[model samples]
Target: MNSFLSTSTARDLSLIFSGQGQQRPQLESILFEITIETSTCETAFADIQYVSWMQGEEEILITIGAIVRIDS
Candidate 1:
């Protein structure tokens, strides 16, 4: 009953992957496809540069963004 939950803020792209060894209940693995300029292909970012609008919102944002959970 475990799985993965993925979401993209820029696009309404969300899905779940569930199986035998993939039962981690996290977004640990991502096989995404992105489009840039006139070319489209699969890609992933090694690191993210996240900027917060609020002064005291760094911890909150990081915590929320790192969450990939299941409702048990």
Candidate 2:
């Protein structure tokens, strides 16, 4: 028989804009950097069991899971 073990974590991040004027190119850059950094850590783990992303009007959601194989 074969089996798999998995673990996952999720976090929601928000960048509040007080007004339309708050929108700026730099803000987008920062958000992009954050997304990249969050995903990079997964590469070091074994196979990624699952991953998902959801975008909201004001926040971004990320879910990541990792799996490891056990020998019996």
Candidate 3:
């Protein structure tokens, strides 16, 4: 994914394993730069796994799951 899509996708995924986000058993992906933007600040991440909470075959809880860059 490009930076824009990566950023948007990253924000969609707020899961941080044991962080505040709802936990899932598993979620994984490769590497890229991602940024979360808002009125006052911006955060960057890379090398993440995007995962989402899905119920049944359709309903979605959290939109995305990703690993934030350790050095970011």
Candidate 4:
């Protein structure tokens, strides 16, 4: 009797929105509004920056810093 074992290949896939040519101005506005609304009661800061290439490739970087109060 001959026995055979089959192995399966696994892959992880991710879907991302592609930037066509330039950064959308509405994106910046939306982010700013959301950050401001969430920071009303808390001392928080949100910083956003983006870099775009000539080939319509871009990356968005966001940094958020906040302080919380804890009582014991």
Reference-based lDDT, residue 9, model 1: 30
| Best candidate, lDDT | 3
Per residue, candidate 2 scores C-alpha lDDT tens digits across 1-72 of 233322223222322332233756664422222323445455333324233233233233333443323333
lDDT tens digits, residues 9-72, model 4?
1111101222334468665221111223454645323232132232132222223343334333
Which tens-of-lDDT digit does each residue in 1-72 have in candidate 3?
333222324433433322444344574443444443445333334323335233222212222343345554
Residue 7 accuracy (lDDT) in model 2? 25
Q: What TM-score fits each model?
A: 0.16, 0.16, 0.16, 0.17
RMSD score of candidate 3 (Å):
11.5
TM match of model 3 to true structure? 0.16
lDDT values for all models = 0.30, 0.33, 0.35, 0.28
lDDT of 2 at 44: 34
Which regions of candidate 2 deviate over 4 angstroms?
Answer: 11-45, 49-72
| lDDT of candidate model 4 versus the reference | 0.28
Better of 3 and 4 by lDDT: 3
